[model samples]
Target: MARNLSTNTGSQAVGGRRHTVGRLVHYLLASPWRVIVMVLAGMTAVAMIVIGPKVMGEATNVLFEGLLGSMLVKMGAKPGTSKQAVVTYLQSRGQDKFARMIDSMNVQVGVGIDWGRFGTILMFVIGIYLISILVRLVQNFLMTRLVSDAVYTMRRQIEDKLDRLPLQYFDRTPRGEVMSRTTNDIDNISGTLQQILGELLFSVFSIIGAFIMMLTISPLLTLIAFIIIPVMALCAGVILKKTQPQFTRQWIRTGQVNSHVEEMFSGHMVVRAFGHQGKAEEEFEERNQELYQASFKASFFSALVTPMSTFFGNLSFVIVVIIGGVHVLNGSMSLGGLQAFTQYTRQASQPIGQLASMGTMLQSSLASCRRVFDFLDEAEEVPDIEHPDHLGQETGGKVEGHVRFDHVRFSYDPAEPLIKDLSIEAKPGQTIAIVGPTGAGKTTLVNLLMRFYEIQGGRITIDGVDTSRVTRHDLRSHFGMVLQDTWLFDGTVRDNLLYGLDEGQTIPEQTMIDGAKATHVDEFIRKLPQGYDTVLNEDSSELSQGERQLMTICRAFLSDPDILILDEATSSVDTRTELLVQQAMNTLRKGRTSFVIAHRLSTIRDADLILVVNHGSVVEQGTHDQLLERGGAYASLYNSQFTKGEED
Candidate 1:
C-alpha cells in the first residue's frame, strides 16, 4: 500500500469536459444579491443611453418650433415680427431660449419628461448617472466580495475533499495540477467577474438600448442598423468558435508547464546526478513553446473580433447616412433628427464591438472554471458519515499498542492484492521485525499498521478496538514514524524539533539536547555556530544525510509515542552514525510496541521476533539464530548482507 501511494499514477480524468457560460454564471449567482445588483446597474445604464437622445431631440424640436413657427407668422404679416430680423434672432435667442427651456423643464420634471420636459430630462440624467455610478460601485464591491468568498470556500472545500478522497485519486492526478486548480484557476474566474462588472455587462445593455432608440427615431435607419448586427454576430460566432479550442488548449498546456516545472524542481538533484540537465531544459522549452503557440492562436482569433465589428459598424454608419439623407429630402426627418440617429448608430455598435472582443476571455475563463470544478468534484477516498460516532478521551487512554491484523487482504487496485489473507499480532511492548527483498510486502505491512491504506477483507485492531471506528488523525497521531528519507521543513532546528510537540506544556531544552545526543545529532549541532538554533533550508540541505536522519530520530525521541514504525530508519547514516542511531532506537523501543522494516538485517538482529515476508505473505517467522538454523528465506537474506558487510 505504501509502495503504491508513493508511486504516481498517470491516468487522466474522463467525462465532464464541456462547460458553458450559463454554468459559470451559476457559480457567480451563488450569492443572489450580487448578481441582482449587477443586472440593475446594467439596466439603469442602458436606460440613460436611450433617454439621452430623446431629451436632445425634445430640445431640438423646441428650437425649430420657435424659429419656423414665428417665421410663418411674420410671413403672414403678424404685427410685431419681420423675416430678416427673426432669422437673425433665431440664430442666437431662438437656440438660447430652447436651451434655457430645456434647463427649466429639467428642474420641473423628475424621472419622467414632458411637463418641464427638459428639466425632467436633466433630472433623469443626473439620477441615472448617480444611480449608475453608485450601482456600479456597489456591484463591483459585491461581485468581488462574492467571488472572493467563493474562491476561498471552494479552495477549502477541495482541500477538505482531497483529504477524504481515496488515494487512487492522487494516483491519477499530479500534485502540481491540483494545486493550479485551487490557486491559478480560481484566480481566472475572479478576473472574469471583475471584468464583467467593470465593462462587459454595461456594454451589452448600452448596445441593446442604442438599437431600440434607433428603431424609434427612424425605422428605416433602424433597419440598416439591424442588418449589421447579424453580420457582426456571425463574425463573432466564427471567431469565438475557432478560438474556444485554442483557449482551452492554452490552459491545458499551462498545466503541463506547471507539472513539468514542479517535477524538475523537486527532483533537481536527481536530474543533475543522472546528467539530464540538457534533456530537462529541452523538455521545458518544448512545453513552453507549446504554451506560447496556444496563447498566440487564442489571442489572434480573439483580437479579430474588434476589427471585424468595427468594419461592420462603419459600413452600417454609411448605410444610415444614405438612408437618412433620403428621408430628409422627402421632408420626413429634420437635420437634428439625423444627427441624433448617427449618435445612436455609433453608440449601438460600440457594445457589439466590445462583446465581440470579450469572446476570447470568456472561453479562457470557462476552460479554467472546468478544471477547477473537476477537482472539486473528485471522489474522496473515505467520506465521513453524517452520524459518525465520536471517540472520547477514555479510548485514547485504553490504547495499549497491541496491534493485530486478522486475515488482512489489501491492494492499491481492486484486482491485484498486495497483502493477501495475512494474519499477524504484536503483543503490547513487543518488537516485531519484517524483512523482504525490494517490492515484497515489507513496507506494506507497516503501511497497514499506520492505516495509510485500509484492508479490503480483514480487520486491523489496536488493543481491542478496530481501526475503522476511530478517526484517521486520532489513530495516526498515537504512533511515531521514522522513514528513510528525513524531510525537514525550512525553519530553525529547534523549531522543527518542537513541531507537533505539546503546545501549552513546556519542553525543557535539556531533554531536546539529550535526545539529540542519543541520536548522535548533538555532535553536528555543537559544531554549528547556533547549535540547536541553526536554521536548515528546504529538506535540511545544509546537513549531511546522516545528520538529517539523526535529527529525525531525535524528533521521534521527543515525541515518545506508544507505537513506533521505522522504515529503513538507518539507511542514510554511516557506520558510526548507524551504531548511534541503533542505540537511540534501542532506548526508544523499550516498553513500546515497535514494527521495524529494513533491508539491513544487522539492524534487526536484536528484534524479539522476525517475520520474513515475500510475495504478500509471511513465509518464515523466527529469531535470527532460529532462522539461520532453519536455513530458510530469512537465513539467506541475513547471510547475504552479513557476508557483504564483513567483506567491506
Candidate 2:
C-alpha cells in the first residue's frame, strides 16, 4: 500500500544553486556592524603577525652590525675607528643606506653594542603580539555572539513561519525532514559561522598582508611564492566541485535516515505486533548505508585538499629557499632580508592552504544554509484580508456559530475537483453530522472550516459574514477541534488540560477538575501515582488511548469554543467510555454549533441534522427520523450498521 507521507521522498532541490549561496551571503552580511568589527580585528591581528617577522629580521641586523663593530674594536681598533671603517666599506659596496646606518651607530662608541635597545625592540615585538591576541579574543567573542544571535533569529523566524504555513505544506513534507532542517541544518550553519567566519577573515587578511610584505622584501621571492597559487586553486576547485554535490547528498540522506528512524521508533509497537522488525531493520540499513556512502565520499574528497595544498605550499617554500639563497650570497639581498622574505613566503602560502582546506567546510555550510532558507521561503498561508472584520466582542457582537458553505468548490489537485458546487448551512446551536467513506473529503471540510486550507472557489461564512473577511486567529478561536489522533505533549495532566487556555487567562484549579470530571478524565488521573501532576512523555504512552481521548475532551470543554468539531472523537474508547464521552460532549456542545464526523452510525443517530456525504457532495441530508422515513442514502448507511451489529 502507498502512503501519503512517503510521496515526497527525494533530495530537496532548490532552483538556481548560485542564488541560494547569494542569499546566504546576504543574510550573513545583514548585520553590518558585526561584520565590520570582525574584519577590523582580523586585519589587525594579521598585520601584527606579518610585521613581527620583519621586526625580528631588524633585530638580527642590529645584532650582526653590533657584533661586527665589537669584533673590530676588540682587534685593537677603537669603536669610532671601526664605525668609520664600516661606513667606508659600505660606501665602497655602493650601499649608501648601510653606510648611513653605520655612521649613526657611532653614538654607542666604546659600548660597541646596545643590549638595552635590542631588548626594547624584542619587547615591542612581544607587545605587538600581545595586542594581536587581545584583538583576536575580542573577535572570537563577537563572532560567537553574532552567530548565536543570527541562529536564534533564524529559529524564531522558522517557528513563526511554521505557524503561518498552510497545512498542505506539512502534509506533503515529512516531519523528520522538517526536523532535520530546523535542527541539523541550522546547527551546521551555526558551526560554520562560529568557526569558518574567523578563519575566512584571517586567511584573506593574511594573504594580502603577506603578499605586500613579501613584495617589499623581495619581489623576486614573492613571484616565486605565487607561482603555486593557480595550481593549488585549480586543484581545490576540482575537489570542491566533486565534494559539493556529495555533501548535499549526505545531508539529504541524513534527513532520510532520520525520517526512517523516527517513523520506525514511533511505530515500534505496530512493527513488533505485525512481526515486521526484520523488514524495518532492512529498510533502515539501506538508508543508513546510503548516508554512510555519501558522508564517506564527501569526507574523502575533502580530505585530499589539505595534503595537496600542503605539497604545493612546501614546493613553493623549497623553490623560494633555493633562489633566495643565491640572492643572499650574490650580495643582492642582505641575510636578514632573505630570512624575512622566506618568512613572508610561508605566510603567503599559509592562507591559500588554509582556504583550500576550508573549501569543503564552506560548501557544506552553504548547502545547509540553502536548505534552511528554502524552508524559510516556503509559500505561507493566504494572508488575512486587509481590515479584517472583527469577529467577537471587539465587534460588539458574539459569534452565533451560524456556518454556511456557499457554492463551495475544492480539490487537492486543481485538475480533479473533489468537491464541487456544494452548499450547506447550519443554524446556531445545531448539531451537524457529516458521514462519508474514507477519502470522501470528510476531514477536508473541517480543514476548510478552520481555514487550514483556502477554498479555490466560492465562500464559507460565519454568522452571515464571509469567513475570509476575518483573520484566521479570530476565525479559528471560535472553533474547538478534537481530532482522531490525540496530541498530548510532554507535560502534567493539568498542564495538558489547560494548554488551550489563552495566555494570562487563569483557569482556577477547581474549574479544571470540573472539566476533567465531566469528561471522566479525573477517574484515571486519580488512579495515577501523581494524579493530575503526572508527567507525560513525548508519545504520552503512559496514558491509554481512551484516557488520552478523555483528556482531549476535557481540553475542549475548558476551551469553551463557540463552535465544536469532533472527528471520530470517541472512536478509540470502549462502549461504556464512549457513552460517558458522548454525555460530556453533549454537555459541552450546548448552545454551540457542532460538526461531528463519525464512521459508526450509532454515534450520530440523534444528531439534529444528518448529512450523508458521498464523493465530497451530499447525497442525502435530514434529521435521523426524517432520513430513516425517506429510506435514502442515510437510511441505507444507518440500516447497514444496525444489521452489522445484529450479525455481530
Candidate 3:
C-alpha cells in the first residue's frame, strides 16, 4: 500500500497586467548596448525600405521625361529645346494642366534618350535595397545573441532557484508541472522573443515611414489611403481580442497535456497490470481534445487577419487608383507619385496584419513568462540561523547521536494537528523500532528527526543541541537514511557508492570494497560482467529488487553515519533476500543510534525499545518483551503478524 502524500494545489499569484508587461520589457532591454546596436541597425534598414519605392518612382519619372523629350525631337523639334517647347508640344496634343504640371524636366534636344540617367536612378534604388538587406542582417544577428543570452540567464536562474526552494514545494507540486514550466514555458518565451522582437521593430517603422512617404507623394491620395487605417485597426483589434484568450488557453492546455503524458508514462507498468489502459487513454484524449480546441480557435482567429487586411488594402488601392488617376490627368499629381502612393498603401497595411498575427504569439509567450516568473518568485525556505551550530566532524568520533523530541507538535494542515505533544529520546547506540499501522505518522517521526519538515511547537535536539539551531546540511550530515523507494541515478556502481562523500573528500578504495562486502553488494557485483564498473541507467531496471536494496544498504554503510534510518528498507525484497539483508543491517547497527520503521514484527524483536504509534501518538513504549507482556497495541500487532505467519 502506498502512503498518502500531502498535496498543495493553490494557484500561485503573478504580477498584475502592467507589471507583467514591464517584466518582459526588462528582459528585452537586459543588454543595453546590444539593444542600442539593434535599434540603430533596424532604423537604418527601415529608412532604406521607406525610401526605396520613392527612388524607384524617381527612376520611372526620369524614363518618362526622357521618352517624351525624344518623341518631341523626332517630331521636328529643334536641338537644345527649352521647357517652353515641351509645354507647347504637350498643349498641341491637347494635354491638360496635370500633364504639364507633372513634367518638371527641362527639355533636352537629342535623337536618343538619356540612358545614363536612367541607369543611375536604377542603380541608386538597387544600392538602397542592398544596404537595407545588410543592415537587417546585422540587426538579426544582434537580436539573436541578445535573446539567447537572456534565455540562458533565465534558465540558470531557474536552476539556482530550484536549489533554494523548500522540499515542501516539491511535496505538493507535481513533478511534471514543474518540468513543463522549466522547459516548455522557457522555450515558448525564447522562440517568441526571437520572432516578435524583429517583426515588431520592422512593423512599427514600416507603418510610420510609409505613412510619411505617402503624405509627401500626394496629400489627397494619402488621405484616401488613411481611410482604411481605422477600419483595419478595428477589425484587427477585434480579432486579436478573441485570439488572445485562446492563445492563453492553448498554452495552459499544453502544460496539462505534458503533465498527463508524463504521469501516465511514469506509471505505465501499474496501469497495464491493473488493466487501466483504457482509463489512461480516455484521460489523455480529454486533455488532447481541449488542447486541440484551443489551438484551433487561436489559429483560426489569427488567420483571419491576413485576408481581412488584404481586403481593406485592395479596397484602398482601387479607391486610390481612381482618385489619383483623375488628379494625374488634371496635373495635380504625377503618374510616378500615384505609383509610389500605391506601394505605400500596401506597406502600411502589411504591418497591421503582422501586428494582428504577432498579437496571438505575444499573448502565448506572455502567459508562459508569467508562469516562469511566478515560479521564480515563490517564497524560499526560511533562512538558516545567522550563527548556526556545527556538529563536530563525524569522522573525528565526536558525534554521539543522542536525539530527543521535546513536546514536539506538528500538522500537515494547521486545523488538524497530526503529532501533538510528542516526545521521545534515543540514547547513543540505541536501536529504536517504530511500529504502526499505515498512516499512523510513522515516517512523520523520521521527517521530524531529520528536520525535513519543521515542528510548529517545541523542539528536536541532537546531542543536547537544538536541531533548529544548526544548519540543515550540518544536521542531516550526521544521519544516513535508506527508504523503501530506492533512488539511484544513471552512473556506474562505483559512482553510486561514492555519491555520499563530500567533494574533495576521498575514500580509500579498500574502504569502499569493505563496505560493499559488509552489505553483501560485493556478492552480486562480482557475479556481473563488469564487477563494480557496470553502469546503471535511470530506474536501474537492469538490477533485481534484492540487488538494488543491497546497493542502497551499501551506500549507507559507506557513509558510516553516526545515526541510521531504515524506513521499511527491506520490506520489498523476497524472504531469503530479506534475511540476508537483515543480517547485514544488524551488523551495520552495532554502534549506531538507529531508527527503524517496519511493518514486519520479526525485524524489531531485538530492538532496545519499541514504540507503538497509533494516530500520530506513541500509545505504547517499552522493550518488545515488555510490550507483549502488557497485552496492549504492540502485543496485539505482534501476535497478529505471528499468527498470520504461522497460518501461511
The CA lDDT of each predicted structure is: 0.76, 0.85, 0.84
Candidate 2 per-residue lDDT over residues 1-648, each given as its tens digit: 255434433123334467776776676677889889988998899999999989988777777667757765664656555466766766787987655655644333345456887898899899999999999998888777778878888899999999999999989988889999999999998997788878878888999998999989888779879988999999999999799889889889988998888888888999999999999999999999999999999999999998998899899999988998777656566667778888888887888988987889988888788788889999998898789887665446568888999999999998888999789999999999999778888888999998898998999998888888889988887789898999999888888998887778788889989888899988889998899889998788778988888888889899988899999999889999999888998899899999999998878877989888888898888888899899888777777778855735
Cα lDDT tens digits, model 1, 1-648, are 766654433112112333445556666678787778767866876686667766666665555444544444544534344334444444465554433333322121112223365566567667766766776676567667767776667677777877777666776788777777777777887787567545777787887888788777888788877787887898799898788779888888888889899999999999999999999999999999999999999999988988898899899889888888776545477655777888888888877888888767877888888877777667655644454332335564535778888999988777877887899888988889999988898888877776667778889888767777777777777788889878888889998776647567558888888877787778888888788788888866678888887788788888888898898999998887788789889999999999999898889989988989998999999887899889989878878877755835
Which tens-of-lDDT digit does each residue in 478-576 have in candidate 3? 889999988888999999988777667779999999889877789888887787898988788878877887788889988888899999999878888
Residue 382 of model 3, lDDT score: 71
The global Cα lDDT (0 to 1) of model 3 is 0.84
lDDT of 2 at 259: 89
Summing lDDT over every window of 10 consecutive residues in candidate 1, give the lowest-scoring window: 104-113
* Residue 197 miss distance in model 3 (angstroms): 1.5
